[model samples]
Target: MIYLDSAATSLQKPPAVARACSYAISHYASPGRGGHKPAMDAAAAAFACREAAARLFQVPKPEQVVFTNNATHGLNIAIKALVRPGGTVVISGYEHNAVTRPLHAIPDVTVRVAAGQLFRPEETVEAFRKALTPEVTAAVFTHVSNVFGMILPIQELARLCRERGVPFILDASQSAGCLPVHLEELGAAFIAMPGHKGLYGPQGTGLLLCGQTPPPLLEGGTGSESIRQEMPDFLPDRLEAGTHNIAGVAGLLEGLRFVEKQGVQSIGSHERALTVQMGEALAQLPGVEVFRSKDPSQQAGVLSFRVSGMDCEELGEALGRRDIALRSGLHCAPLAHRTAGTLETGTVRASVSAFNVPQEIPRFVRELRQILSEKP
Candidate 1:
């Protein structure tokens, strides 16, 4: 099958990632839970993963990076801890439901929409200038909108938030590994990323780098402080609770290593080249409306579009029948779809990964063209 939905989750992982998980299973033990040999070994391996993540994200300390179930979990933890009762949270119009739903669920948040494409750095900075008011306690922005491959100006926006003394939480679910994320340069207060997406790890793995030590969301045993009833005041320990996802973290560590060896810049360039090729092909096809930046360099490895007179779901299935995998509908970012003016029927999402190449693009384009021309 020609898999084009890496944005949802990367299917094929590196061999080392699988090996790491296998090693963890065979050596089965709880990390940081006990003084046993297996426990120590497991804990050491877990810390190695944390260190690799720190290096990749440019986080100052490995302890600040906490492993979570997924990007949604990390986002919820950051939002719940950062959003105050009387304060406002600034979010872009093109935000995933993960950010919007939780904020809407909160009684005190004031949502604002700005007319700026995420790929336009100046527009993103201006969006913050309009949204970051005195009452705004924190701002949540997606590093890359899931619906479209719009790469937001995170560093510029984060600078504005830093000046205003408002925490900036970046949901890097779509751009974490596909694009460069320098946590230090961005000065982001919190960064939420799924290991399964760009990192090419297991589905259950995710990372939450508490850049500025956000408040605790989950309170429970961290296996470090046995005497404390309340959550520890430490960074990751304060937020991390219960038994850790050791195997998942192990796999994620291997994925990070793979990314480092492959070089993030090269992977990014490769994915963008593929996405641009597909975008051009789709644009030339009759009745296809491509939703992405005109400049390929401004976008990530995502392509969103819809063919006229065809249902998004049916089109997706048609492509699938030809062994071409694609995602359809909202892509968990209804606000992005709404902002891009593609919300009604949603759009077909083709998210390319580092594994995809130029050869796969033509097959996908050919099938898509056939699907669009065929009768329902």
Candidate 2:
């Protein structure tokens, strides 16, 4: 099968990731839960995983890295920690439901969307500049759109937040392993990413990088402060209040190491090259509508398009039956579709990964064309 849904979750992982997970599952116990060799090894492995993530993301200290079930879990923690009740919060138009839902649940909070044109970074910056007023309490922005793969002007938006003293939270769910994300350089108060996407880890693994003390999403025994009723107020132990997913952490550690070894820029380039190849071919097919940027620098590896008179999900189902795996519909980010004016009919999303070969693009395009031709 030809897998092209890395934006949702990477199906092609480095062999080491699976091996590391299997090894940990068999030999390791919960970190800090006991005094046995298994527990000790688990604790050591968790810290080492943090160190690997720190080195790759340029996080100053390993303690700043907090592991959670997935990017949504990390995002919820960050959003709650930063946003206050009845305060105005600014967000980009391309945020996933992981972000919007939490904000909606908050009482009396005003959500002002900086709805910029797709693939227009300058327009995005301007939109943010206008929305990021002194009264705005904080800002949340996605590093890349899952639907359109439009790379937001994060640095500029971050600068805007800094100038106005608004706390910035980066939803790096799509850009974490696909681009260079220096914690200190960006100066974001919080950054969240899933380990399962470009990081190539298994599902149910994610990281939240903190620049300051964040309120715990849950309060429970951290195994460090057994005597205290209150949770410990440290970097990781404060946020992490449950048993460690030792096996998942081992897999994620290998994934981080793989990204570092291959280099983020190198992997991103490979994926984007595949994107360009597929995009060029798709643009040639009659009755196909391609969503892309004239400036390739403003885009990433994801391609969104639609065929005339074809339902996006129907097309996706057809492609799936042909053994070509991709995603369709809103991708849980309806804000992105509304912003891009594709809310009525969501586009087909084919997101490339580092493991995809150049030769695969032609076959995909050919299959896509055949599918369209078969369409009534």
Candidate 3:
């Protein structure tokens, strides 16, 4: 089957990822829990994984890389750490519920949406500039839009936050392994990413890069500071409670190595090329509303569109029958759909990964053409 739903989770992964997970699960013990060889091995693997992630993302040290269940978990940590009740937080209009819902749950919090048109970086940055007041407690933004693959001007946005003294939290769920995210350069208070998505690791694995100390979300056995009533004031121990996932860490380490070996720029270029191939052809179809940018640099590896007189899910079902795997609907970011003006009937999203070849785009376009005809 042709898999194009990588923005959600990468179906294709390096062989080493699975092998590492299997080996670790069978042979490892709880990290830092015991003095046995298995426990020592787990500790080494966990630390190595931290070092790898820290180096890849240009973080200052390995300790700052904290593992969580997913990006949502890390985002929760960042939001809960920096944001207080009744404080104001600024966010992008294209944020997924992962970012919006947490803020909504906060009591009396004011949210300023930096609403911008798709592929319009200047406008998005301008909107953010207007929203980021000195009084705002923090600003949260996603590096890329999962639905449309629009790459926000995060550098400018980050700069704006720094100048305004606003703590910045980044959701790198869609950009982590697909694009370069220099944590040191961005200097965000926290950056969250799921290993399953662009990192090509197993699900339930995530990384949270920290620029500042994070408050503990869960406090339990951290294999250190035992018999202490309060959580250790360190980074990982403070945030990571309970036994670590040795298997997931092994898989994630291999995934991180694969990403580092291939290089983010190379992978991103290949994915963007496939996206452009799909977008340019789909835009020509009569009655098809394809969201594309004249400048390829404005978008990443996702192409979103819908045919007239057809619901996006219906189109997706037809493609599913044809053995083309993709997703349709809001992609869990209804705010993005509303901003793109595709909320009434959501757009079908085709997200490419590094493993997708040049040949797959034409086949997808051909299949889409077939589906459009039946709908018409």
The positional error of residue 145 in candidate 1, measured at the CA in angstroms, is: 1.1
Q: Write the per-residue lDDT of candidate 2 for residues 1-376, one digit (tens) a residue.
A: 9999999999999999999999999999999899999999999999999999999888999999999999999999999998889989999999999999999999999999998889888888998889988789989999999999989989999998988899989998889887989889989899999999989998999999999888899999799978999888898999998887889999999999999999999988887787888888999999999998887777889999998899999999999998899999999999999999999999999998889999888888889989988877
Steric overlap count per candidate: 0, 0, 0
Ranking by lDDT: 3, 2, 1
Candidate 3: tens digits of C-alpha lDDT, residues 1-376: 8999999889999999999999999999999899999999999999999999999999999999999999999999999998899999999989999999999999999999998898889998999999987789999999999999999999999999989999999999999987899999987999999999889899999999999997799988888899897899997888999988889999999999999999999999999899888888888888988898888888889889988898899899999999999999999999998898988999899998889998887888899888777763
Q: Which candidate, 1 or 3, has the higher TM-score?
A: 3
List residue ranges in candidate 2 displaced over 4 A: none
CA shift of 234, model 2, Å: 0.7
What residue pairs clash in candidate 1, if any at all? none
lDDT of each: 0.85, 0.92, 0.92
Q: How do the predictions measure up, each by TM-score? A: 0.97, 0.99, 0.99
Better of 1 and 3 by lDDT: 3
How much RMSD separates candidate 1 from the native structure?
A: 1.4
